[model samples]
Target: MGNKRICVPNKKEAPLFSWPWEDLNNYKYLLYGPLVSKVLYSIYKEEINNVDTWCLHILTLFVLRAFVHQLWIIYSNMLFLNRTRRINQQGVEFNQIDAEWHWDNFLILQAIVASLIYLSFPSLANLPIWDFRGILCCLVLHIGISEPLYYWIHRLLHCATLFQQYHWLHHSSKVTSSFTAGHATFLEHLLLCIVVGIPILGTAFIGYGSISLMYSYLLVFDFLRCLGHSNFEVIPYKLFEDVPLLKHVIYTPTYHSLHHADMATNFCLFMPLYDKLWKTINTRSWDLQNEISSRTKSRVPDFVFLAHGVDIISSLHAPFVLRSFSSIPFSIKPFLFPLWPFTFMTILVMWAQSKTFLYSFYNLRGRLHQTWAVPRLGFQYFLPFAAEGINNHIEDAILTADKLGVKVISLAALNKNEALNGGGTLFVNKHPNLKVRVVHGNTLTAAVILHEIPQNVDEVFLTGATSKLGRAIALYLAQRNVKVLMLTPSTERFIKIQKEAPLDYQHNLVQVTKYQAAKHCKTWIIGKWTTPREQYYAPSGTHFHQFVVPPIIPFRRDCTYGKLAAMKLPDDVEGLGSCEYTMGRGVVHACHAGGVVHFLEGWKHHEVGAINVDQIDVVWKAALKHGLNPL
Candidate 1:
């Protein structure tokens, strides 16, 4: 038989009726319901029918109950509100915002409302205002009316100008942790309280309840309000949510937190009715996990402004050009093709030719001006002559350095084989004062060289254009308190990269344009060489080089064969026979042989079983060596 599911009774169920209690309930209702009904019943029963005195007594009772209820309700709500504030304080440190503004405005508004209510209803004061019925009536009016009114006024305060001047102080706490709820100006608080309280009290007075009863009802409402605002969500009574009426009337702590986060929604105080009616209720579940994930996933670039600039240019320029082209007539556009294509080709050809011709022109100009020489006052000039391969310019550099009496350091040509074949070393061999250094190997080693330069060396010269490597050298030299000067084909890329990747050289690194470098005494010729990938795969030098290979079958075979063969076998020969000894041998041999063969063959396909076994053995050996035993 299927297991039976246990059923439990709901806690809210109560007995239908009890004789004496029912009678008492009826008696209380009769006493509080109405004075006219009581008087009529007395007269019909012939019980002391003094109509004038009876009427006066009934009027007094009605006035007293109304007054008492109002007072009780107000007191109760205030206590509950204070309690919520206190609990919120325990959870976090409070920081008040716009203290003077909040207190002054809110408190003044409250005082004005309270004074008005007191002056308008003086007859309520003459009656037995301290009575239970009067207090209960007052309490009910305070909560029922005040809550909806507060929501409306509070929403109004969120209007642009009003919020900036007053309401913004209340919502300053964006995180809205527990303590943030009550951290508002006194004026703000007072205004809010009075706005809510006065309307509810007025409505209750109109409903014919004694003031005392309103006060009592208010006390209950205030207690629930405090519970709703408290960060603690411990509901002691499980049946509270089960009852339709009670559940609908009460607000939960989570409901209040949502109000703080999204101020425009969740305006109702005691219940969600006003919010629902006004279409301002926020019923969406808060997912903190998703919020955190989104924050972590967002990527903020290091140079955000530059990236933004690039985006703006790309967006604006393309649209502008497209619109300009679209406005032109189609027949006119076909006629303009000859001129447009010729102009485009001319520009492209000029750009390509300028790269080489520009460098040569500057080099020749420097030689004629006797500017390719370095001064003795600790200035090192790095001329990128060899990279551009203008031999006549390099000769000019040597002659200028010799005349200036400055030590010339050369960054040997990168294409050493070609340079040697071309007899470029003849000039270097002739200049006995010149020193040549060859930079080889990885980037880190280059960094190390820049780190260890002799202090006596006044300046360091780079033989090529300032690129990533050039920037690194500049930063390194700057750190060592050395000045760097570079000679390049042009200053365009150098200026751009320098701005993008700012080096904290602190005035140690300086860039001389090809024009300036040419005007100086000494110049170094640096040759430019393109990498294989840049030349063939990505002519524009844009794509990155990454090598990825598949997993090897040999590694997998090694794991499977190594693990299974190491397992403990049965001791009895007869048991081995029963276990199919020949089959077991064949399987083991196959795995071991397969692994060795694959290892020899250099197979690059993944083999899960062998990989698992090899991993198991490796881990086992490592653990054993480390004196770690699973048992």
Candidate 2:
């Protein structure tokens, strides 16, 4: 039988459900703000030899814990690695992630308690910086007292009454991340603080404690906790083969995952010795760990949606970071402001590296699909000299996908800009014999926009009329006998698109030079970004439909603004933990769905260069048939 899945039992929120600053949202960080300020002010006052070290130590520990968790998250989610080693294949959705947003609140609570302890016992202050005796005392006390204490308390929490009241929250995440280690009720975390404190306080009260001992012990505890919950198996089984007794000395991620999967077994903190003594260790732990770690290669994706980063701040909205933030439409938030400098540094690092990296992936109808990101930022694409560099990234991604047996690769956002690479025409023409189909996916994009326009509307104002999508839209509408007021400064370009229509229906396409000509028009198709001044020309009831990247600001409150063309994915999609940019769960941009439809239909042709007006309806029909509903 396949690995048995244990469902988390339904439970109400624990009685002690709320965090200190639960409603503060991002401002929750302000709780520790005074502590941080104390550190800086103490340093500025040249008081390093004084009590400032306590705050410094706590701050450093918090940073280190967060770093370790993030490092494990990145490692576990990496697509290029051997994914067969992944323990829990089920995805963590947005709701579960949002519930876990306060995972680190336990650290903040513990730090506050530590501060109170330091104040209560003045003897704990200004301890020696190094003490070899204290280190040994910490290790001894932790293994003897903390490990067994934690194991028993953990088992107790699993008992029906406490499990339903508190522990169920921790077990709720079917696919555990590093943060999963801390996602517990306040009561459980309170118990954890006591379990952790006994080791350090035991050393301190015995006159053996030191700064190094405290820091090292707690940090090691955090590191091991994160490792155990980090769903992917990183520990090698050969170590156990070399030293057979070591399996009881320490626990593996696979061992811990079994606890989540079966619930009644493997209830140890860091050592399996306790579980073995209690006979709670799972029978399949060793076999499964070896099975996963023995694999060398990751599965290949059938399709790749080549996406690019939008901006520095939004970069943190990936599956690895603020997952709660990424699950919804991306917007600038105050909490993200503090992270701008760090994200800016990351941008510098990405600029130096010139490889496409896997961002996220999911399974659709048993076919593996992945999204790869070009390291360049959104604004970088607009730079005059940056075109070649951007194209090089796209070409490299396409060639790499071709080599990896990726059947189709779609260009998203500005990656297929005409000015950048002729809507991906440059690569196809340059390579000439590529096995992988390069799709701009604009046919479905155009179809989504066209369908959004009401059929009863006879006249429409079209901006960016000479552009790829705009041109196709103009031709399609004119052929259907809808009067299209094509707005462009270039009369030559407008006429070129006008002639594409049949000779009988060419009059339906009108060349207009100013937004004033569209004052009487209610249906506005905006392929170009419309400014507030330009938007003012539309009548009060005008509905603005756009295919513009970044989307235009809704300046006219009186008018209704339609979102960018997008489609909801089929219900059968699996492991879709991350949202597609701003789109909600199971929803993706139309171009992304276009690529999915392209793969589903098993088309042999590449959808590059320009859109085929004839295939607009055909691609749209295929998308709907494949369960992609337009949003």
Candidate 3:
């Protein structure tokens, strides 16, 4: 049982020893606000009086540790940076991601402890800022005392009783991120403080301590700890080959990854020398690191879903920022309040670049699937000056996907805007012989909206009646003898769509200019963004089924609102660690699912230009047959 891996739930029974404020959730960070304020005041006091730098040094060290850990987090999630070099190929699920949300709690605990230490010990206070001799003393103490002490304690924790109660929390994450290094129970972290403090305090007891030693020792300790849990192999294998003995002295990300996978081996903190002396090292660590490093080519996916940022804030919902945030349906949170300025700066930087970046990927049915993003946000698609730039990025993505031999590339959200590039028709027309199939996937989007209406309903009100999806929906319903109240101001566009229906059904399609015409209509299909005043025209119990981007708000309590069209992926899908915007786990927008269905059916023709109204039921049935359930 000690060697077995445990899968913790996102919200589960509290382990034996939990953090004091674990119940606070996101607000737990507020617990350290007082200490942070004190640290800031200490900096001001030090500059004015030159009295002591103890509090200032602690603050600087804590900030440095956080910066290093955050850097690793960003680097690990960059899929464009040689994904094959990642140590763990298995995706991290929401359960593990959510559990690690309080990873920085350890640092907060340490800051409070340091404040107490300063108050109690006067001899160690007001020390000089630099001492070269103290650095040598610190290293000696760490190797002689801290290293051996931590190794034995770690091994003891692996015993059955302790493993089940405490150590299991740290090992719960099979796929490690930099934050995983600090993801442990209160007891474990408290013990870690002792192991970390021994070297610093020992140097002070010997009269060799200085502020430089404190910063250097703690920073290196944090840098190495974060490096081991980074889930990406950064330390080159040639270094171990050149030094020979360095393999036993330092641990790599792959070495620590093996320990998480198999709990019985490689049980050392940062250094592999202890594991080697105790015969606990995993035998496969060295060979595996070299194997992952030697991979020169990246995996080419079978299908690609080209997505774009919905807004300035929601754009940070990528896998790298916070998996837990991205895994759930997005909403404005108090925690994100301070990040707006930084996110705005990032948007400005993205606007200057014209590259399509890889966002996330997974494996399904022996084929690789990927999601790529055109660096433009949803609002940018509307600006007249930005249209040409947006189209160029989309075109670049298509040409690149074709070069990589991707079978299908689906344009999603604003990437397929009819006004911008005629639903991706511009690309297909430019490159007539391209192997990759460019798909707007609007057929599936229309099918999802159409099938949602109750079969018993005879008359339905439609908005954006002249649009691609609206036109298809109107003609399809008219052929079934169901009257469609098409809402449009253009008579020529409405006449063109109505004539496509049979003569017997042409009279069933009626064009109405105002929302008042739908006051008596019970079912409303929204293809455009609607205002609350317009929504007031519908009666109680009217359900608004929409294909609009960023979905409209439900202003009326008496009426019902349907989310944007989406489909749940098949259960057999593997490595789907991230959620599509505002969708739950394993759910994707209907257009994205359309591309998957197109690939699975081996369809050859381009799904770009205008959607085929006849293929609506065909694509819907195929999706259902392949286990894509409508949401």
Candidate 4:
């Protein structure tokens, strides 16, 4: 939520649900309870005949719930849409969306589901609407009977073979949309219906259930599912807190979201009790739910976005060979190192690795003074022969973050190039056990780099001009009417970039294919440098900014770069003292800063593909405020 200072209990001791009355601040949300009751009462009126009413009511049940679901969404959005995203998951909340597909699917299934279970005669109107015993019995019978069946059946579907063939579709939207609730395979959909059908239909034949109770249960059931998928949590949690046991008996929207987010956990549908008993509950679900339930109109959002730096293999050769060689009992082998055999071996390793980069990640815990972690994904180097390995490294890096429970992650450089799904559809499709969200942090990086440019710089020289980030920056400068000197190894690529530049800024280009064209420029951007070291050079006197991780800082040893500055902990980070990092700050790469900015801004869904000019302005403003835009 955009709110600041919302109190969240320490996760270690936090309960699954908070006490509602204790939340006096959000007690206003409880006001909607009566509104909910009033609307539901009107929808579930006394029926004329039990038989026709059962059929009519069964169909009416879905529509009534759909109406309530939509109304709840609109009502919640009116007050808390921007303040909170979804029912319980953190970061930016979604706007009211068309969940017609969810509605349509249910409608499509309504007739089939009704006929299959003989939903023709509901219990008569003899049972009072306020008959508390009848309602409690209905609620419990459903929970007791349906959830255990749903749990085991659900768990069975997760068996490796079945999951890939059947369940992946339902798990597709880790971040649920309304349709997400209805997005499972038709078989899965039928099973969902059967779970509830047993309770509603069983009451009709048993002679004690009422149309009111059936619809009420059905209505509440739909509302909860929609609530689980809507991505917003408006229930005053303290109500459950006051009734302590209600927490275990009820499931919140966040609880269900955890199921979709990370499969293989939270198997029970109605409540987590079965999940708890079966030990199938996700470890992080409760604490995360409490974190969301604890939100108020005051409190900064606490979402962590992870990122990583990747380098072309050639760049790491100098470091990898230097380190590996040094690590070898160098003191004992000092004489050997200078000899022909050792020297020849070192050069050979560097040569072979010149094409591929190493595979590893470094944790950046305290550098940003916020909860941001980046695992710079790298590979052994380029083997024009084995590019697939690099792709695997990126995949491995993503799985690493997801398994660790990161909520959102940003892909940089080649990682962005390889995994820039319009909505992360690819990763969602490929990684079934996936949980973490992905963002191409290109937007904020665009913002920071643009901010780093000194006002005196007019003409810009950009290298690797055809790369994803490079292309974005080039277009942005063109949009701003700034002249650019484009240099890349490919003439075709440079020309393509020139054509892509807006017509108004076409004359602003000093387009050149030769590397020498970058000479004498006031501003230079080493845009994801991928060229061999011997072929790349920076203009010594110009203000140069490198955006890649482990930056091309040594393009020229004598050229000055931003001095690495150490961060002062706890004091700079508002008492989060456990964060560990040696103080250092020169220019942290723009990609890392991009991840940090998303964490600070509470933007969980601000997934950028190619950072646009507008995003640059937003991030630039934030970077300046934080003093992270070092030139």
Candidate 5:
């Protein structure tokens, strides 16, 4: 029979055997024979003919077998306990309400009950009904009875009324630790132990059984019970699917934990037979639930504006214009057709007319014929026309320059493919008065090209949003004495470039004081300076020139306050300043009833832009002052 020891709490001190380490030593004894084996060999050598020596050797072997069996059980228990303690100490609170009580007492009760059932089997042979058939019947009975009985009692415990008061406590711990397997109420433990034991014992009594078989089964069962509670995740359950006999066995740790976690399901305790027979098996649910929970916890919204920035440039603005032209009607579109018919005829006529008629009407006090010979200065214009906004700003700047006979240079547009190619130069021959170049190269090559440009290039007009290329260009130009004009669709990018501009410049490039430096001529333009294409295109139109208003140039000061606040202006500014200003060879003049004077002053000083007006005002003022034509 297997050994049994009662553990009374504080009533008697159980022998302290150094626990886990002692368990390891016992395992060594099993693998290599015990110290008594050598002594027995010596005895056999000294007295070869003695009958007592043979009997002693037999006794030693029996003792050794029992010791090894008990030692294996103790070792397995030690492993489970050690793992449980470590997990518990990690501050991993098990949701199970009665975790402490169950871990300490439930397994002990089950072990005791299992031992009793095993020991009781030998007594069946002593009874009046003893035969070979009876013994064979008893072995089968013991093996099959406990599992079904355990299942029924387990199912009953899952009823709502019983679960809330008792079973829920066992399932509260979400992450099932080693010790948590046995963590359940004492009454629940007692019910499981008694219900399972009665059936197995009843069968053992009905059929006579050998005590030794009973002993071996019980010991192995207890050892396996401890193994099931071990934290080691070594076993692969998939390996058992092909083994017909082993596949039907009771209580794999994996299968059992699922039952404890969700009592409403997986009611079978020892085997999945009842679960499968009743159509209650759900092996994949636990993993599925875990996956879904993780996904839910990490969910991110699709329209997070802060992370990706406003889609004004690509999604909202560009699509609106593209769709408007695609849907425009054809009847009234001929009136908006180009008057000129050559390769560059349409563009040249658009530039000349916009300057002579539209610009003169807006800026000059007199009629166009009288103001035809008026002298004007010239200024650099950076028009970013690629994705969200169109090339209308370039058209507008050209018109203004042509009316005043100012010099203009158009930068070639970089498309998505060209930009991605990362090494090439694009040349446009359409406008003889303008020099248009597009840089399509790797960042280092682009940087090198920018560095080669002479420092004497006084003012720079930059178009496009804050990209790595754009930022690098701004930083490089700022290091020289060149003034920068920045324009973009992204407000965040605009803000970031503004902050990085000064630091990016060379430290000793200019030793001028802050006031003098502020007046040292620099301009950055940003915003929807021109009217949107949707305003001009018909719902089903086919032409690109039908885009309205070329592009509008508002002084930065005009839009800095109230509805158009690009960035907040200082409170001291009262109203519009002057309507005319000069920079380089250009003269910028505005007729709007806003802060045109501040814009003009900013143009002369080469300020980033008038805080309240469109940046186009700076370009106009600069061109008019320098006596250069955009055409």
Candidate 6:
């Protein structure tokens, strides 16, 4: 015990302390998040008075938290107010009804047995609170002391190399119970105590908080820790949903639940403030919470369509397929494949050049990624060939999709063309038992293309206007009193498509053109246009749909265009897969969006060959309402 409050941060460096500065709520205690670091770095900082005494203080807090935490675990189990599904590494979980209340009995004993190490330390107790202010100080100081250290260490624990070795023990409980809070290796527990206790000890040695406050902190921290790890969310996030800034201040059970479920984001100790700053916070934290815990079942995803590079530009998509073919085959060389070889990659090697066709490509490759959130998840698979260059591996991609419980599959790019008459018959005829519906994903693609045109713009310059997708987008906009500047390689073909769709373009203020712009329409939809790279140019804020693959000519460096699509989508979207990066691109074309669209409408055994004009708005509005927005 020593002197007065010794350390305070300078105004300039401490932005975290400032309220409403960057939409953060103002709390009375400005000093939080990294306050312990400020204190340790302050002028009043002191060396330990006695190493043994500091050691004894740490030991006492651990013992206190352990015993109290154990009692709360038992008490909480008795009440069982918030039991939830237990998640695991491989995406498998049991029903809540299937669970027995007493399954956690060994877990409590496990925690108690793990705490026996504290017996070796010298007896220490009776930490007392000196004053009324000390209680507040204790609460605030605990958060400040532990947050920074724990935040950094927690991030370290998530490092891929370290997670399996050290952190997986705690993550074993996907749906965390109170006992699971401290369920870590001794090293992890000791480190956790150090990080949490550092701030407490930092202020305590200065006599800022009393011994009673110190004990209170130990107990309070244990309670909150248990609460954070508690599977069910007790705090109504809706309580502060109206207050934008207040919503950002505190942590919720769902916040931590996401960490267990996804295992990639939400890596802060208390609040997600540090996570927000670091840009690692899951964009779908709340939606994921509801999706995972909600009683509703059919709303959950039945299937998801994931693919590698899609489309006919073998020049572009072939590289991804070729790489897959060059690697040791998944079916053939299961013994040689390294590191989770059997889990996600479902490969098939079909040697070509046997009188059927002429091509050097020997293998049709498919990758089905499994990032499980619940019983059914979306599959992330790879396209076999770049559009028309090699045989489309629709069957290979479909087989992997079937294995992942994918009920409906979107044949991205040329895969759609491979199906007879652009209908998914080739796949439907083969895989009858899987009941996998094959989708061109073109109508939804057309729907998304039409949606991408900005309201500020009077006219859209649609490229490849005569093509299947381009014609649909042009008519949808033209009919809605929007001026359409249709760009086509052939004027006659463009007019034929307009006449074919039976929607008169000229009467609807639609102007068919041959690659020249008028009216300075800044917003452009680059649909099905795959000329050389230089042909694709637009203003800085241009939003291009570019639904056809070999995607938008890889946009010139000097010219900037924002590729718009639905992002951080709500889980309710059928076949919605991981938002976490699975491939080279994050924002996908309308093809992927189409699978999600078809899944939601419950169109089993339905095939959308060429997108009709009438269905465009229905799909676009659905995508827009749920998750399709500018992100």
In model 2, the Cα lDDT at residue 307 comes to 94
- Candidate 2's C-alpha runs over 4 A off are 1-60, 78-85, 238-245, 383-385, 429-434
Give one digit per residue, the lDDT tens place, for model 1 in 7-94: 1244321222111222342243343344456556776786744342334353454444333433332222222122222222121111
Instruction: Score every model by TM-score.
Output: 0.28, 0.89, 0.90, 0.38, 0.29, 0.41
Candidate number of the best TM-score: 3
What CA RMSD would candidate 6 show? 19.3
Q: On a 0 to 100 scale, what is the lDDT of residue 360 in model 4?
A: 17
- Scanning candidate 3 in windows of ten residues, the lowest lDDT window is 1-10
Candidate 5 regions off by >4 Å? 1-98, 101-139, 142-144, 227-232, 285-631
* Predictions: Cα RMSD each: 33.6, 4.2, 3.9, 24.8, 30.5, 19.3
Candidate 1 yields a Cα-based lDDT of: 0.35
Candidate 2 per-residue lDDT, tens place, 554-602, comes to: 9898999988889999988887877777777788888888888999999
Which sections of candidate 4 miss by over 4 Å?
A: 1-55, 75-103, 116-136, 235-242, 296-631
- Give per-residue CA lDDT, model 5, range 37-142, as digits (tens): 5446767677543333333333443454344433432332232223322111112211221233224344334434443443554344333333355445644554
Q: Decide which is better by TM-score, 3 or 5.
A: 3
Instruction: Write down the lDDT that model 6 would get.
Output: 0.49
- Stretches of model 3 off by over 4 angstroms after superposition: 1-16, 33-64, 241-245, 262-264
What are the per-residue Cα lDDT tens digits for candidate 3 across 1-631? Answer: 0111244456454454677776776687676576567667766666532223555566677788888888788778888774878887766766666677778888887877777787788667766778778888888999888998999899899998787778888887767888899888888888989999999988888888987788788888988998899877888888988998988889998898888888889888877999989999899999998877677777789999999998988987888776657777777888887888998898788677767888998788989889999888888899999999989999999999999999999999789999999988999999999999999889999999888888888999999888888999999999878999999999999999988988999999999999999999879999899999999999898999999887999999999999999999998888777789888889999999999999989999999877788899999999999999987
* Model 1: CA > 4 A from native: 1-91, 94-116, 119-121, 130-145, 174-194, 199-225, 285-631
Q: Mind sharing the TM-score for model 3?
A: 0.90
Across residues 432-543, which tens digit of lDDT does each residue of candidate 4 receive? Answer: 5665656666666665566566665678887756666677778888777778777766767777777877677877766676666665664767765434452244566655
